[model samples]
Target: MVNGPAGRPARSLTQTLPDGVRRTTLPSGLRVITEAIPTTRSAALGVWVGIGSRDEAPAMSGASHFLEHLLFKGTHKRTALQISAEIEAVGGETNAFTTKEYTCYYARVLDSDLPLAVDVLVDAVADSILDPADVETERGVILEEIAMHEDEPGDEVHDVFAEAIYGNHPLGRLISGTPESVTPMTRTQINNFYRKRYKAPEIVIAAAGNLDHATVVRLVRKALAGTPLDTGAAGPAQPRAGDKRVRVQKPHTVVLHRDTEQAHIVLGGVGLSRYDDRRFALGVLNNILGGGMSSRLFQEIREKRGLAYSVYSYAAQYADSGLFGVYAGCAPGKAGEVLDLIRQELERVASSGITAEELVRGKGMVKGSYVLGLEDTGSRMSRLAKSELLHGHLMSVDELLGRVDAVTIADVEKVAGDLLAHRHSLAVVGPFDEGAFPPG
Candidate 1:
């Protein structure tokens, strides 16, 4: 048996995993996790790295995302065009994305083409040349991307909300660095960051659909051979440290003026971490409030009052911090009334808790979405990676559904009171000055 995080014994190789799922840890400390779905013709694979925007220093802001773009530029053995041509030759697609806490490069291809997918992806990630010319090219592209983001206020307000909560913390910074930060960044700096941070122990390779776990492991090992990732024996990296509390700024209002047709507002505050036992309860609460058309926020804000065309509630959880927010897009003139209505509903839920009937519907919504989301290979592959990389273990679909089913009305009330009753920070974007919305 191998040691797991915190020096505990992990599941032995002989131990039974969830149905059709298997895992192996290489001597280099990289993990390969897979789920076999015999009925599908296509397979999905992802290389998940533990590092993300939150891992970068203020000066290195957006390094993770910048590196993501650079990796596709070329590698030691394959030209950029050759890389795309090889994948496209097989009618496959590939892409990568950066999140606050991790980054993933993935591809979906026919099961027979998984070997090609594995080789090309691993080569790009492990042996990228980081050409100086490519860096300058992507820098300009990223700057233009940042400029374009400002044109969409509905999307920009969420980032503004995060900033309102975390202030200058790394978590608050944009995943794509600002023009000021990207323009001056050097290729040498990026190359150094990539070599130092992308270690074997902090990476997980996951694949799903119409494949064998053993074969996937073999492919990964072959693909990694002689690359920077092929290191001497080690154990998988310990999960991110979650014992320390993440400090958040005091609740306040932050507004960005934009001459837009609609106002976008996000109101919320600090919430339970992903590790909290109360997260299941919080999930149920979120669904009951605004998960679907039948949700309370949709009914009250849009159906009953016709105050907004779009309204919803969401919770974002990280290793040691989280936030729960309600979002609405409406006419600029109706911003104040919409905000008040959101506040009133939050107060009511926190005070009286959800009823038994609401609790049942909420649980159903949570379970349904979770199951329906996994119907595709990409989602299944992601689930395997997230469980291993983020949560430290794989939880079966049944176990997850059970957790949601176990939430009691009192549990919902407890999480509601703990999260919603706190002072909230507001972020608004559209036709308004900074002081348009006063602090609560």
Candidate 2:
């Protein structure tokens, strides 16, 4: 598949990292990454495409998610049921999901069934038919899915908050576009998106669990030999680029009045990008602030005052922007007190920073979760793919733990002052009017 000068064998272009993980690029611009976990009997494989909602035009908002469904509907050589049956017959599973930055169709099977896994997953991604009748059938299913999501006030308010924060940017829209946008989306538009974005240059096949890198490569090469997917000359796509700044006019409030018992609130402001070095410090700050039961928010709001049962904070990082938010569930009448305490705690941290004891606790919690989570082959596969997709390099476990260890108390203070010192916005879902909101 190499595209060098005529008549010579094309040497592989690859980089093998620590932990025996390997990243290889085919001549056709397809990238493949794999990890061999000797103790595991099963293998997990994913075909990741680099197009998601952020890549869509305004009119094409939900196309990436829609294509996720269509790929499983059928392919040129296999019916939809047959496609799934093959995997299930081997005691395997197949599923897919779409996110803001990418889409993945993945499978888990016995290591002996890897060739079948590669063949089926590649066929689904590279050879789907996108039948007209199947498109129409899936339209109703997706509409009902939207209706299902909207019915849950807690779930829907996050989208409302995103719209409030991001305004008209594609990042502001729901992953499942509005009923209007998706209802009338046609097959021709979907086919065009698939043909254009689902190319070898933007695809990665990642595998973990018991496996061989050379054999996996050989299987993938034989799988697409004569197809239109055979690329003449191209390289992998560059990471998505856009600096759509969050344009909030001071602090704001977006309240959806659903007749619910507890107010679901998300409060805070813009924070770090995925590439920022300070993210390690930010993680520590999030932990001390509201990441666990022993965290400040959980201890103060839920345990001491009994104001809420679920109270926490989180950070969401993207290619060029991110969001940091604190979430709590409480009664409508107590919303004011909750917001005031939140503000007071943030002011305290912004002014004096967290104590040294808190830093050690935060580091311990982060390390525990990090190490335990990576014990799964699926988790390893995802990490390997995402590192290659976003950063174009792999960070070892030792390196990750070291980064967390390096976060100092002063680092926390400076980051707290920089991110949490500003006037922040609020989003609420409950039976409350604008007049009921707490002071900003």
Candidate 3:
């Protein structure tokens, strides 16, 4: 048996994978997973590291995002301009983003250019210079980004809602971080955080489209040679455990006063974790409640009453905790009415549940979105990486659809009752005082 995290037993490196997909774990503990799609002439490759904003301490809040920018600035092998110019010369694209749980640097190019993409991305991620000058420049850019984010009330309300739910928890903090955190964070702090946290065992390399899995693995191995990721033997890190519960603050109303044209509001509460079996049921409920224009919220708030231009329900799941929220952007005068209607509908669904027709329609929406999203190489590559990095196993597309199809009306009702039972926290961003919204 291979050594896992903390000396626990881990899966063998040569386990069987689904059709068109393959996985290999290197002696250095880096994982390479791939999907071969012969019909397309393009390929998408992603280097996914299992570290993000949530992994940071308060002093190092934006370090993950800052490191993302610095990685692209320059590596020992290539300058920043050469990095972009090389990819663009072949009509390809490369970019990276950091989320709450992980950071991904990806490139999409013709299948013939896969080698170039692999070399560039791996070199950048595994051997960045992290120059002090580049760090200072990125610091200014990140501060401006934080300011620009505050200007968008539609977006800011979601952050407010998260803050209301999680309070001072890491999940509630901004991914870009605040001006205070970004300005004071020194290069040494960030570099130390990067070297300490970005472990080979905690990384996954995924590629898809018109390629052979063996060839992709070979390319990645060659690219990683002599890099920081090339190290002693170890098994891949295990996925984050789900048993540890996240501590949350009590529900309350939080209003950010901004003189905006539309009032942005979110009403929500605690939700199911990603590992929960009832998540399938929650997915169905979300689609029915606000998945599309045909959803209950859209039909009631926008089409029927003309109360809001946008209204939707969303669910976000993490390893141990999650959030369920309903967002509506409406005129300031109509905010109260819109919020009451949302509460009424939620209560109605909770008490009575949805009908048979709604259940079928919800299931169809979930299945169609999942399948259609995989039509491109990027999504497929992302699926491979996320399954390995986040879930620790890749469920076949058919298996996922089957799981959704098995959800019955009873399952939906049970989840709805459980999720909606708690008092919802409110977050409002508009021209309003702190007490404009009542306490939950």
Candidate 4:
């Protein structure tokens, strides 16, 4: 039997590992996790900054995402072109992204070039030259990106559905700010925002690959030393609205009319929060539904009937709350029938529990996938840091596998029932009749 977190006789995973993989913390509050795979000579390193759209204030909305792009433009020591050239010279890949709850910059390189990766990322964050000229250019680039999303019917619909689910909360806001918001953001505003939020020494730096723990510490320390600590803003709480049961129908037959071969249909509801205890059961339940082609949704909607090309159910787990959804693209004429099939599967999961074989397969698949995620250094580092940020501690791989295995058929039925009890807000982007979606 495994001991719990509070147990006196604690298990140590570090002691059993090879000498290179180590976990350490600095006095400045940065958590450094490194894993050295001797057989392989490549490494993946990532610095996860625990701030995203959810952290943005109304005035500084989309600042996190904007900062993500601006950081790559130039730094104190390296020009934008030089930064790209240097990484490419080492056969390394570098990129950054902003999500609802966090922003990250990462690179993958040969083990010998780990120091270069660390230096580039640290410099990008610290000496982020949010040049007024580059800021203006990037603003245009961001606006074009925003326009592209606006023009895309399927993407617009999902954004609408998210707004309906979260209402006026930050969760409802688009990660890419509106054209008006993105346009007026000045270089000063961008720099001030970065200085206040991201110029912190408290962020996490994790590397996975063939590397030394002490070496990683030295590189990170030297990279971040003497940087002003960020006394970050007390970001406002993202509102968690209760279950919503409503439907909004567009006046026109097809919204954002596009000339496409197939129609895009999105159906979903308010899902569980990251803190919810039933998250594991809910995840298993989703996996059994449309996570894999062998699942019920695929068999019923695609394989058997041949109604749609793709059908899947997913849950977007967030800090405060999440959304559970299913999406598919079907023949323009078969949208209604496809909806019925999806509803039937949802109702069946809620009413009649999955078979024993199905339960076993679902649990086994979840367990296998969990283990596979640790094979890559970047994946392991992300899993460790994200779990800590969201769950307040690290949960071992065995613990996660056990949780996935512990979900019973009854638990699946309960989660299904809870989700299906509410009417879903529908978002359809296609060429169809006005009465395509009835009121929920």
Task: Highest lDDT: give the candidate number.
Answer: 3
Candidate 3 versus the native: TM-score? Answer: 0.97
**Which pairs clash in the backbone of model 1?**
none
Q: Taking the tens digit of each residue's C-alpha lDDT, what string does model 4 give over 218-241? A: 898788765554222222122232
TM-score of each: 0.97, 0.96, 0.97, 0.87
Q: Model 2 Cα RMSD, Å?
A: 1.8
Candidate 4 total steric clashes = 0
Ranking the candidates on TM-score from highest down gives 3, 1, 2, 4
lDDT per residue for candidate 3 within 32-87, as digits (tens), equals 99998999999999999999999999988889999999999888899999899999
- The lDDT, on a scale of 0 to 1, for candidate 1 is 0.91
List where candidate 2 sits over 4 angstroms from the true fold: 1-3, 6-11, 242-250
Evaluated against the true structure, the overall lDDT of model 4 is: 0.74
Candidate 4 residue pairs in backbone clash? none
Task: Give residue 21's error in model 1 in angstroms.
Answer: 1.1
lDDT at residue 90 of model 2 (Cα atoms) = 100
Where model 3 places Cα greater than 4 Å from the true spot, the runs are: 1-15
Model 1 stretches with alpha carbons more than 4 Å out: 1-16
lDDT of each: 0.91, 0.86, 0.92, 0.74
Error of 2 at 370 (Å): 1.2
